[model samples]
Target chain A: MIDLFLFGIFPYIALVILIGGSIWRYATKQFTFSSLSSQFLEGRLLFWGSVPWHYGIIVILIGHLIGIFIPSGVMAFNRIPLRLYILEGTALALGLLLMVGLVLLLVRRSTSPRIRRVTSTMDIVLLVALLLQVLSGIGTAVFYRWGSAWFPQTATPYLWSLATFSPKVEYVTSLPLLMQVHTANSFVLLAIFPFTRMVHMLSIPISYLWRPSQIVVWYRRQAR
Target chain B: MDVRAQVATVFHLDKCIGCHTCSIACKNLWTSREGAEYMWLNNVETKPGTGYPTQWEDQTKYQGGWEVKGKSLKLRLGRRLGVLSNLFFNPNLPIMDDYYEPWTYTYEHLFNAPPSSEQPTARPISKVTGKFMDIEAGPNWDDDLGGSPVYARNDPNLADLSDAERAALFRLEQLVFFYIPRICNHCLNPGCLAACPSAAIYKRAEDGIVLVNQDKCRGWRFCVSGCPYKKVYYNWMAGKSEKCILCYPRMETGQAPACFHSCVGRIRYLGVLLYDAERIEEVAKSPETEMVAAQRSLILDPKDPTVIAAARMNGINDEWIGAAKKSPVYRFVKEWALALPLHAEFRTLPTLFYVPPLLPIAASSKRGKYDLTDGEFFSSLEDSRIPIRYMARLFSCGNEEIIKTAIKKLWAVRTYMRAASVGDISDQRATSAMSELGCTPEEAREIARLTSLPRWSDRFVIPPYQREDVIQQLTSPIGHKAQVGFGSNVPVRRGP
Candidate 1:
């Protein structure tokens, strides 16, 4: 119980604060841009890193949810068996690509002394958290050998317990320590969700779906 | 007879299988370039789940749309941070790993290694942030109540129980959940339209699709801050912002958007409708009852001959109207009045309407603890029982009545959009559009003169070499092949 409270509940509490703090900070920061003429070049590293990393994370998360949520009975429908292979394989591949992209971004930030100067301690901490999540997840994927041992039957029941707030640490501990770490890290990440750059991950792309399509004619201002 | 028309679409959530076929279709058609891989102009997300791009609905956090502080200039909310805000916004962008790490099995290894009895275990070669990051819950997380509605018809916390137990629980709990698939509302008065500091974003004069002029975008990121939906994506690499173009090209050729067309459930509708642009501000400012009623009044009925005439004058087509008549959207938005607009109080006057699904009731539990009269279970199925305060909060100009009335008006807006066709317009309306987009009367006349011209630039122009630079900057940042940045220090070697 203490372990559950400390590792599971306490981390969740911390995650909430971190996430909430990250979001509040980001919001106020964004609110500061009041001028139209001011030009602050956005780092290309931030842009590319944000998009691929975010989108990749989304696909991966969905794939993870499927692995966690779908029942074995449902997996039998519509050649659902094949879907697991395809979805899991796709996730693995995309995850690798995103990992590469993120590394490039990190390298760019570090090597570019100018960017390095601008880099904050919070940025480093956020990076560490993200890196820990990825490393552990990847380790779990590798150790589990990508669904060979029927993890859902074991892991899901425990997850179901958490949903109802009747969590049993033994069920979680029954899995490999790596898996446990992944789960704990995930909750930590969730707790910190509202705080870091991670908050942007919550942005809806709906505007991209229904934005208007009127053409705008601009009169370019020539050099005075 | 005016023939001018605007184009619009309606997406039915039921028909969407979440296959991303439309996303792929749109990607192949437009966003497949180096700078666009991360962008999903078309993406489908299960509600209750964090949507693609994350917490997109709550504008207070992500900061999208338009803000009207300056002389209506466009800016990026992220870049606009104050010096203090900058310190706070550090790495305003979440690291790639922070979002999620990417990984893949070595293809060569997979190809060479023989599979075991089970599928060959995939191993990761190189990995970035390899695990899932936070940012999961959505804006309506508490109310979304997703999952198999039938299974949990009575209980808020859907659980696995015996049939008898479930039935017993149902009598006591008597709860229901609905699936609401939504897309861009293409509001009548778009916050994004008003928030642009550069006057770069505009609503279509014909159908009402709002878009940003890429070339005109100075990357102020104001839209990022002002829009409540946070749908706009800043192309940091391009020094611009990009959003949904409503498949204008497809609409021009008379087809639904990729997502709507590709929807396996066939729940989408496409058309056009005329609205009184003049009365928008007045309607928006009035009391909730008047606001909703006024909003509803703006919805022009295509069946009304006068409305049809006005529509035709704007370039709407009969085919569009006919399709709209059969449209599921019309039934949901207008007739049954089940669908409603999202966040209407923001008062951008969104166009998309969603019909909340009616899931069946589960069997009764424990006779009737809440209300047991004899052997019969009490019907906890009253629509009134569902707290509509959230709905009201989304659309009630200031009061609940606005949401109540917006139901009918949004239905009307759906009617108009279902009939408007691209370029199927009256010459007069074309001229009006030209004027609105800042073309001189002579230029408008010239465009009209060349209406038959086969070739024209469909995409808005970027400054000379701007498009090339944007692509370079987005795909290869710093050292990744094509470095795209200010080449200030590099000396041009002239011929000695």
Candidate 2:
């Protein structure tokens, strides 16, 4: 029954909250769709925490997308023992790096008076959930071992099964307790996403890389 | 010809007394709010000394303004990529110490102090920290310290002068300084506009006053480091950026900005100046040495038939055009060429012009009975107490020729006026001097009136910024006219 609720009803709820809440925020309070940087007030730790955290999470996120979205391809590649080991090693290294960045950031927030003053209650929740989620994922990988090969058959099918309106708790109900917790927490984090500064994730300003610099918008209406 | 008229300003530095009445007026009007304690939209500083924010011109530290790379001007804080990289952290932003920890005296201490035989005095407390603290520095701490080696000797503009010349600056006989009253330059190419990630800062198409949309500002703080003049300030409490609005409230009502109106020296001149908007990009990209001339060339003759026709085509009415024709700023900055923009090397193409001060000639006792006066005002600037190199650095882009011409024209105008009124000097000599210095007799007479004896209306030719054209779109024009202050209608304060 619990598996049914976690795998079935919660995914849709998280998706609805994530999409609906973000659109509402952008519409009503467009200015708040920002990172709201505290680096100007306290910077030295951000240099160490932010740079590694950004790059490491990006690698891990891309790995997750590849696993869930194109599982057949990922499984085909993971068939070879050498390839599986190489892929597993790279993923573990990134997961470790993400953990290090998270610890440093938490230390920075607690220690720096300026950053601590600006740090919101929602900010603490977001960081704590992220750290726990990453730790659980790392634990499941270490104890159970070889998630790359098994995840396609278990979790990927279960996730894909949710898309077809069929509640398939049977696929992952038998998995380890840590894995179950990891999956449940990820969905809850998604539900909490819009309520926290983590909403800044949606706005990366990636267009600025290619776009021409120094463009100013005018408030007037011109005839020509 | 995309002719749009910008309201320009000229500050005659010679007349400026550094009284800071302009600063006080601006403060009382605009920046007196709770979070805006540190802001001074208008401030006067003694030259040959560190300015308000202490070494603001040290671009190496502050990294404000643009950099000249060959023919083009680039932001000193890099292009879009660099801006995005530094978007999270601005290393170059000024700290409280740089601008002084804006303090107010705890006058209540005088009332609350324990009864004492000696006098009870109030102590200064930091407004930011709200704690008792030692009073360190202020907006103009180095005022009137012209000969102080610590302040005047540390000026960045003194780079052009030799060691001996710098040392001579503090000598009793050679001591010289001038008041440079500063406000936002309201440039043709504003760096603050470019650096704003939220697209909050913009120059008005109607009048070209650069302003920030307070609602849209997310306090990213790039604008603080973007403006080379250090005019843009961050409101830490409000989480937004603010700057000189050019008193748009007063301007909309066809009145001068508080700073200009309250100037004790009457050094300020405000008026509409018609310029070709199309030339802005090209002029901004001009060679570093040629930027000032290029910017000046952008200003179109208000009386020119072609300019008038183009301005009309663009919806500029006859009244604005008429104001441009009589604009005292246009006469000083364009026709007479007595005024030049401050720090053209920044390449922001600032519209505010300065009529450089003509210091008293450095009288040498060794020459004994040398003829001190050939009837030229301030002695041709060659024998001036203030270094020409310093003034050139301040006004021109280190071009001495431009400063010389302006000084000479000022001398000719002064001579012409003295002859007309005082009658100690002959009319023939004044006429000859005007002609020699490239100012015609008629031009000199006009300059004299505009500079010395301008009527209040003549000094400030405020144009009617016809908001009715824009306002009529939403509501009844008459109803809107009852409610003044253009942006006051909008939700300008921070939203919950």
Candidate 3:
């Protein structure tokens, strides 16, 4: 009963809160909606912490999405001997990089007084959960080397079944404890995304590169 | 010409007495909060000395302002891509040491100390670390120590001065310095405006005052390094950038800025000048030596019929144009040519001008009788204790001729006044002096009146800011009822 609730009911609850809470925050706390950058307080550690963390997570996320989005093509790509070697090597390297970056960030939060003061309970909770998720993920990938080849055949269909509102717990329920913890932790991260500073990810000004150097926003009309 | 009126200021360096009343007033009014304690939105610096933030003029250290690249102007530090990438770690930003660490004394310890013969004293505590610390530096640590070698010798502006000229400035007998009170220049091309990643910093169209919108500023310290003047500051507590708002809340109500209003020397002159906005980048990218002249040339004469027509066509009402005509800043900067902009070489084309100090005449009283140079009427230019070279470096970017011209005109006015009021010298000397400088006797008297005894309203010719016309643009201006300051009952319009 608990497994059914954790995998089925919890996913819907987390998704609803993530989407609805983020929309509410955007409507109400527009001023507070920011990356909450601690670089101004202690920049040196953040350089190591933020850069590697972002790069590693981004590449890792793309690799995961290939199974759900391009399951058949990825299997064909992974079938090749050299391509599979490269894929697994890249994944292991990025996972280790993500761990180091997360450790440095956690150390900075605990050590830097200025940064520590700004950090909240939610921040620490999120960080711990992320640490657990990363650890479990790396463990399963190491212990089960060709998990991607196996995951698409099992987990992708299970995700599709979940998305299509059909019960197919048999696909992912039989996975090892390490994989189950990683999967469950991701749902918790999604549930708390909007309430914490993580919502700032939606507001990145990536469009600044193409815009003009000097921008003058006129709140009132030029014509008097 | 895209003629528009810009409210400008002039600071008479001769009259400033190094009183930091303006700085305190600005601090008390704006930046006295938790993370803002380190910011001095207004400050007075002693010339021939390193300024606050210790040699902010050394662009090599801060990497601020703009550089004239091959055909265009690029930020001295970095641009679009740099702005985005520096989010992880901004290497160029000034740490708290550059600005003094904000500190507060532990008063509670003194109050709660056990009774003893020795008086318990309050000790300084760090605001950031919340612990006892030895206080080392402050906002104006080298306040009056202008002649001290440690602070004064390292002034970055002294780079252009010849060795002998620098020696003369430091000589015990020839030691001369003047106060230069600084505020954000609200430049024609503000580096801070360009470097803001969120486009949070902007120059207001009504007045040319540059401001940072706290709501939008992500505490990206690019604006801090972006300003050559180093005026923008980050508030670590709230994670936002703050700067001198030019007292816009006050100006919107037809009042002078806090620093200008509180100037003890009455050295500040606030007024408007009609200028061509389209030529801002062209003027900003001019050769460093020619920047002052190029910038001054951008200011169109308000009295010119074509200029007046263009300004009116550009939507400046006649009343604002009238204020620009009577503006004392224009009279000093453009008409009599007494004041010059500070650090035009930065190529920001700063709006604030400084009237270079005239070193008091060299005269000796031997055995009670004063034997001044009677025929010369006044001390010659070479007789000046403060080198013209130093003044030129500060104002004209090594152009001594410009400083000489301003000093000559001021000297002519002084001699001309003495001849008119209490003449020990003949009227012919004053007439010849005025004629040599191409200034009429009437012009000299006008300069004397404005400089010596200006009426308060005359000094601050605040153009009528019609904030009243723009309330309807707000969504539900009266939505908060009496709580909203800008709640208006009328309609407004919009255009870009």
Candidate 4:
């Protein structure tokens, strides 16, 4: 019953809240969508925190997506013992980098009085949740070992089943406790995503590269 | 010609008394919100002192406005790719210390304190953190040369002065300063507009007012670092950048902006200026020495039939063209050529102009009588307490000749007026002085009247915005009737 609810029911609930909540917020309260940067008040520490955190988390998220999309490719790449070690080593290093960056950011939020004043209760909750997720991820990599080699075989199928609207409990149910926590916390993050500053991730501003340098808006007939 | 009409301004610096009525009026109307406590949309600063953001004119540090390379103009902040990388961590963005941490007094202590032997006092607390703090600096920390040794002495404009000239400026007898009131220049090539990654900042085609779309602004803060004048301020609570909107809501209703309307000294002048939009980039890329002249040529003559026809073709309408013809800004900027744009070298083609102050002459008391050291009826231009070189740096990008000509014309007007009313100086001397600058007695009289005795209507020639016609083009008038007022119905809070 627990496995059925966790894998089948909770994922849909989290997805509904993430998608529905984001669209609702964007429609009714669009102005609230922002990174809510505290760099103006305290920049020196933010530079140390924000840069590494973004770079590390982005790469890790892309890695997870790759495992889901091309599980066969990852399995082929990890066939050789040397290749598997390299892949696992790189993932561990990146996960550690993410941890270090998140810890610095947390310290900055707590220690700086100016930053603390702007820090919301939701922000604290999100940060703590993220720290726990990263810790569980790192623990899975250490204890379970060969996550890159096995992720495709077990987690990928489970995720694909979930995406296709079919609940598949057998694949993830047998995974270690840390691996389960990692998967469950990711859904938790998704559920709370719309309510936090993390929505700024959707606003990447890539279009700025191609847009005209100057923008002149016309209220009446256009100027010649 | 792609002609467009811009409502421009001119500040006659000679008439400014350094009173901060404009700043106060702007504060009361627009920026009296929680996140905007530190912002002063209009501020008057002593010229030889660091401005509100402390050394804003020092472009080397701030990296604002534009840099001309060969024939192309680019934002000093960096290219598009550079801005993208720095989007997360903007190196040039001014910290709170740069503009001073805003503070308010704990006034409740004064009212609620129990009876004490010592006088009850209100200690200052930070507006951002809400913690007790020692008040160190403010928006106008160096107003009227307050803390002159620290702020005034370090002025970026004084960088090129000779050692002797610099020393003479600070001497007790030679000490001089003038007020320079500043608002956003609403530049033709606005750096703030160019640097916005989200395309949130834009210039209005109807009138050249630059505005930030509150709904689109993602708060990357490039606009803050992009404006050379440091006019754009980041509202921490709203997580968006805000600037002087030029009181457009009021202007649309045919009232002057709050700052312009409340100017205590009557130094502010407003009017429409028709310009060729196609040449903005070309004008902005002019060489440093020719920047002022290039900007002047950019403002098309409204009285010219060709320009008028072009303006009409561009949908500027007859009312704006008529207002442009009678614009005080045109008279001050192009006709008499007495006014000059502030920091034209910034290459923004600032619409605002300043009639440089004819500062008090350096005179000495000899035998209990004030004696002009130069021994001329109008003291020699070189004898003016504030060096012409300094004014050149401020106005004409180190073009001393331009500053000298404007000052000479201003002095000629003063001499011409004194001869007519006071009769202390001979008419022959005044006429000769006026003729030296090719200024006739009639023109001098007109200048003096407009300078000193302008009525409310004469000072502010607000063009008919015809907002109804403009709005009708985008949406049905009946449909738009419900949302006609200023600001969003929902209060702009930080997060969902």
Candidate 5:
């Protein structure tokens, strides 16, 4: 019953909150949408913490996304022992890098009095949750030994079931405690995403690459 | 010709008395918020002293404005991709220490203190930390060259001066400094507009006032570092960058900006300047020595039939054209050529101009008696306490001749006025001084009148914003009337 509720109904609840809350927040209080950067208050440690954290987490999330989208491709690549080792090794290094970056960020938040003054409750919650998620992910990779191989078989099917509006608890029911924690905590992150600075991830500003450097806004149309 | 009407300014530095009434008025009207205590939208700083952000003119440390590479221009901060990569952590952004930590006295301590032998004191507290703190510095800490040895000695403009000249600047008998009031330049090529990753900062097409869209700004902070003058400020509480909006709401109603309205010395002149937008980049790319002249050439003469026709074709109304005809800025910047843009080498093509100050004549003591006459009448300019080279560095981008001409013209006006009113100097001597700069007696009288005795209307020739026409095009004017007002409808707050 717990597995059915945790793995089946809870994902839908998290998704509803994630989508609805983000839209509502965006429509009602659009001004609140920002990274709320504390770099101006304290930049040196922020440079050390923020840069690595973004780079490492972005790559790791992309890897996870790829596993969900093309499980067959991941399985095909994992067929060779050498290729599997290389893939697993790279993932482990990146996960470690993410961990190191998160630790530095946590230290910066706690030690710097200036940053601490501006640190909100949601900021602390998000940072702690991210640290736990990364730790459990590293834990699952270490003990289970071949997450790249097993993730496609188990988590992807379960995620697809959630997406397709069908419950599939058996796929992830028997997973190890660390893997289960990793999966559950990700949903927690999604549920709380709208209320945190993490929403800045959605605002990547890739359009700036093509947009003209100079922007002139006109209240009235000008004749060319 | 891509003609655009810009409401520009000319600040006569000689008339400024270093009063901060403009700063106070601006603060009370706009930036008395929690996050904006440190921000002074308009600040007057004594020259030969480091400015508010402490050596903001030194671009090497801040990496602001733009740089010329071959024929094209790029942000001195970096390219677009570089800005994206550094979005998470901007290395060039100034810390609070650089701009001085804003603070307020604990006024409640006076009322709430327990009975004591000594008088109760309202100790200083940090606005950011909300704790008792030692006050070290402020926005105008170096006002009137207060810390001359430390702040004035470290001025970036003093880089080219010799040791003797530098020493002479600080000597007791030769001390000289002038006040320079600064606001956003609203440049033809604004570096802040170019550096924004979110495309949040923009210049208004009608009036050329640069503004940051609060809803779109995501606190990347590149705008703060990108502006060469360091005018853009990051509101830590709002998580958005803010700058001088040139008081658009007030301007739309045809009133002068608060700073211009409240200027105690009446040194500020506000008027519409019609300029060709097509040549902004070409003029910004001019060599350092030729930058002042290049920028002057950018301003289209409002009286020119071709320019008026182009402006009409471009949809600039008749009122703005008429205002441009009577523009004091046009006379100061183009006709008289007395005012020049500050730091023209920054290459943003700043629209704000300054008529550089003429310092007190350098006098000598002859055996305990004063000898005020230092040879020829205008030759006193050569021996003035403040060197022309320093003023050139501040205004003309290392071109001494531009500063000399401006000072000579101003000296002629002063001489002409003294002959007419005080009768201390002969009219023949004053006319000779005026003739050197090719100034007629009538022109000198006009210059003297405009500089010292002009009325408010003559000082600020504000063009009608015609906001109703703009509102009609965007939405129903009736619907816009319900929403049109000063201050934001939405509360500006920081995100989690």
Candidate 6:
């Protein structure tokens, strides 16, 4: 039952909804909120609020990348034995920071008349999804521990199976359902990447450093 | 770097009287804001003295631009290099406060004290509120660019005098300096457009105008630093960057850009030229010697039948193509066998062309100073002491070969403009389309004439975007959430 739910069912549902839904959102003309004025922050509440939350999530994401992408064998040879502990600690701190920041951001968005008017229902749900991921990741990292010699390598492969549509849940079963939910929300974010301002990440400006601040003048005269 | 249209500019330094009308015009049109009160986009400076932003050209102190080391082009300083080019130093970028002080005005004394009228009849006395506002100086304020306390010694044109002569000239305080006019280059390969991670800034396919789509901007300032020219400014108040729009709105109509229309010197021209877009990368990557070779191949002779055909497909016309083919401007800018990039080492292939200044006949003759003598209007053909001409060359190409060729490329613009004004329509089809679009026949004729001329400046008109297409794009939600298949009812488990 656990296998069916974690691997077979959850993976398939996530793949379709996260990936397919995002593509459709971008293609279809429903409700979009994009404007030049979105970056204006009227008060300190909004400024301090969003800064920490967004930063926390970014930090957590970086930790995850380092842990998953770096090969364990290479890490072992390099004598980097405390990698998990470091990542776990960072995840916990960032998770707490994220929650605090989210509370501030959400409160401002909700209570402030102007911000409330601008925010949509979807924005709320997206924030909630991120919150759930933060909470679950922090909870698992703090409560669960593997022996120093043995590293659990099943979570990522199980994730890959779901990504590829061949969900196998036996290894992931050891993980709390909350952890599965957290990972699942991450996929949802990925699916939405192309359809949101998140797409700004892919831009390339080759001459970013040399932009000068001067006026360019071109002249012409009457044909004489 | 496959630019559809070749955008270029030619500045006649000798013609500029430095009245600063152009700077005022641009400031009124754009940067009249509380935060931008001190920002002067086009201020002229005395070279040897402190400049407005204080030593902005000292790149050793403020590191910017790309440096090639074998194969890797890396960021010199900042977390972006150490952190996978994704993370960077926090946006609290080093500011003027770190270097100097900022000053502000206060008018509180008027209310605090009583003033006197008539032989000092008492009523409300005013004083300049002595609140010491910390005024932080910018990076380019030190070298005053040969203005104000001006003399032969400090002047670029007069830097060769004996030390004693230079001292005598300075003792007399005999030099007068004024401001220069400026605007966006809208470069062939715009740094701002390239640096945008979101690809929000785009160079128009038809006009080579670079613009930023406000709705698509995410407030990332990669373009701010990326542009070696620093033409792109960060609008901190708006959270988005802003730049000179090239007056596309005016261009769409049968008019010139505001700056050109309002210019007192009449030194601007507008025309079209064809270039191979695929060669930009080659020109950008090639060594100095190879770059000229690459560009020579790419600069098309618009009069050639094959080139004309290709240009026409891209919306260029015969009248314009013909004028460009015959244009001395074209030969000087491209074929002069000497047109070089302003800072070729920067790697951004800018399209603006500049003709270097002709050195004055006498090394020291201050002849023929003609004053309008009528309400601050005056010009002189003789005073070769002023280095405005040399300044123009400096702004365009910093190399000697390009400079010499540019000086010889005269009358190209004049001939083209004359040919255009008389209804020698460059592209008749475009003219007819202008008429169809509700423009007066006279306006259409002028566009045909102006565009056909082999010059780079002309009166401009704005083009129209597809309203329905833009509306649809604006109304759509970027990210949407919809329920899909069944929920995964996996049992909740605690960590072992």
Q: Write the per-residue lDDT of candidate 2 for residues A3-100, one digit (tens) a residue.
A: 88897889889989999988887676654544656554456788678777877888898988888999999989988999999998888888888888
Superposed Cα deviation of residue A181, candidate 1 (Å)? 56
lDDT of 4 by residue, B435-495 (tens): 9889988899999999999999999999997876775323322232222114444565788
Q: In model 1, which runs have C-alpha deviations exceeding 4 angstroms?
A: A1-108, A111-224, B1-6, B12-35, B63-109, B112-178, B236-239, B286-292, B303-338, B363-387, B390-496
What's the distance in Å from true for residue B358, model 5? 0.8
Candidate 3 chain B — worst ten consecutive residues by lDDT sum? B487-496
Model 6's CAPRI class?
incorrect
Off by over 4 Å in 4: A221-224, B365-374, B472-487
Backbone clashes (count) for model 4? 0
Q: Give all TM-scores, in the order shown.
A: 0.45, 0.87, 0.90, 0.96, 0.96, 0.54
- Alpha carbon deviation, residue B289, candidate 4 (Å): 0.4
- DockQ list for all candidates: 0.03, 0.27, 0.37, 0.64, 0.69, 0.06
Instruction: Give the docking tier of candidate 3.
Output: acceptable
Candidate 5 residues lying further than 4 Å off, grouped into runs, are: A221-224, B365-379, B472-488
Clashing pairs in 2: none
Candidate 5 lDDT over B1-496, as tens digits, reads 8999999999998889999999998888778877888999899898889998999999999999998988889899988999888888888998899998888899998999999999999999999988889988889888888988889999999999999999988987667888999999998899998999899899988889999888788888899889999999998887888899787777777778899999989999999999999999999898999999999999999999999999998889999999999999999999999999999898898889999888767666778877766675545666878888898999999999988899899998998888899888898989998998999988888888899999999999999877666742232222322221123355556788
Write the residue-wise lDDT of candidate 1 on A1-224 in tens digits. Answer: 76677555765577568767665654544321122111122356555565576567877777557657784643453246576666556656776757765675577567654345334454566667777777766666555655423456666667676667776677767677777777777777676555444543343222432343223221222111
Find the 10 residues in a row with the least total lDDT in model 2 chain B.
B476-485
Best by DockQ: 5
Model 1: lDDT of residue B463: 11
Candidate 2 or 5, higher lDDT?
5
Q: What is the C-alpha lDDT of each candidate?
A: 0.47, 0.79, 0.80, 0.87, 0.87, 0.47
